[model samples]
Target: QIVRAGAPYYLPAKIAEHVSMVGELLQFPRLVPKKVISVGSPVKWANSCDARGCANLVTPSVIAQRYKLPDESLPAAHQAHTSNSMAVAEFQGQFWKKSDLDGFGTSCHRDVSVAKTIGDEEPHGGIESELDIEYIKAVAPEIPLTVIYNGQFSLLKWANQISSMADP
Candidate 1:
């Protein structure tokens, strides 16, 4: 399962909380590192100082090639990376309206259409950047693999909480 936090950019701390909650509810293994994919903006990192933002710097092609994928496979990987960059640009242009850091004040709605679009673009990291689907197809050819994107509600809630706490 590709476990990602609910949106609009859920804080790391709250995501931890949700993970714990879900783990407890399902009696699943507590905090397995391999199962989680932190696709949240890398801007939260202390080392990145670039102004172009997180999406621009994320070259999935470079990453895919790093995995030793063949040269012919590079084109699709590049396409996926370019598509992801475009999607991010569109999202920021359309959604990020307020100049203030905390523009949406309260909880923000998840754009399901956009999320589905991104999923449809298949930005998974593999030979063709369609790794997730391709992997499942190869391993369990008959079984249907469904990609579920958890909305960013918990993320937005956590961000609001953080902003509120910072307002001292």
Candidate 2:
């Protein structure tokens, strides 16, 4: 409560000095409540916890087929996304297991290039980055993919790096 009251006076100044954007202020994050449930059990979408019903299961092939591929060549058959700055105490970036990717049916990917992970302790931290890669790879198998983890804790740095990229 004190922070919320004081944020109006101090946050703007601090943000102006060091941050390019302000998000999730004065509000709790929207996340699903983690709970143990039997496999294949009924589930509710989003942040709901009540066992309302089973979640819709869509096969990767079906998802891939649902959308048509672009007629134009896919940027030399390459797909990529940049990982933004993670919070302090958060996991550093780390590559997902190749076996998991294969299990997800992305076996067609010849190789994945991860940039800007030379000094990262974990290289790639969460499944989010891995999932991002897997989703694209699953949808468009055989496409070369790149996972660029922005280890910096500042969006401005990531922005600058992206701006400096010749082909993004």
Candidate 3:
């Protein structure tokens, strides 16, 4: 039996009255980091499972050749970015690493920082940012991408900005 003053089992009137849950260990939630998989250029089909599986990886060059786009188009994957910005950029956007657009197979990413520091939370560790960055970069390799992070989005300010842009 637990004889501690604060343990659930410990229920002495005087001790319980004085200490609700003092001297107890704090149990923080477990943060099981996700296993990073499928990074960099794609791999060709593996001849056998024995060897690291190859194949199935498709890069910009592969996509270009397959679709037969003009050579001038380096990535020639996704549509060009307009003045407003791509749908992905409307929100937090993507930022796994600051590096330029790089994806599997015939693509490149510039080395840089893409995320911001919020409170004690480290930047560039979000699954949303990672996924968005990877896929968007894969399709729009040529487009310049930026990430603007903030503790508060200021919905009122955003609304005002949008309203101001509307036919004044």
Q: Scored by CA lDDT, what does every candidate get? A: 0.30, 0.45, 0.41
Best by TM-score: 2
Q: Which ten-residue region of model 2 has the weakest summed lDDT?
A: 45-54
Model 1, runs deviating above 4 Å = 1-22, 25-56, 73-145, 150-168
Residue 137 accuracy (lDDT) in model 1: 27
Candidate 1 lDDT tens digits, 110-137: 1111122221222222222233333322
Question: Which of candidates 1 and 2 reaches a greater TM-score?
Answer: 2
Ranking by TM-score: 2, 3, 1
Q: Score every model by TM-score.
A: 0.19, 0.42, 0.32
lDDT of 3 by residue, 2-52 (tens): 333355455678778865343323444566899889678855631211213
Better of 1 and 3 by lDDT: 3
How would you encode candidate 2's per-residue C-alpha lDDT over 1-168 as one tens digit per residue? Answer: 333434463456756887545543564446688996766866433221122231344333335445754422457434433342221121245445555555444333223323333224452236775656555555554444545555555555555655566765
Q: For candidate 1, give the lDDT of residue 85.
A: 20
Better of 2 and 3 by TM-score: 2
How many clashes show up in model 3? 16
Q: Which ten residues in a row have the lowest lDDT in candidate 1?
A: 103-112
Write out the backbone clash pairs for model 2: 92-125, 93-123, 93-124, 93-125, 94-123, 94-124, 94-125
Candidate 2 lDDT for residue 154: 51
Q: Give the TM-score of candidate 2.
A: 0.42
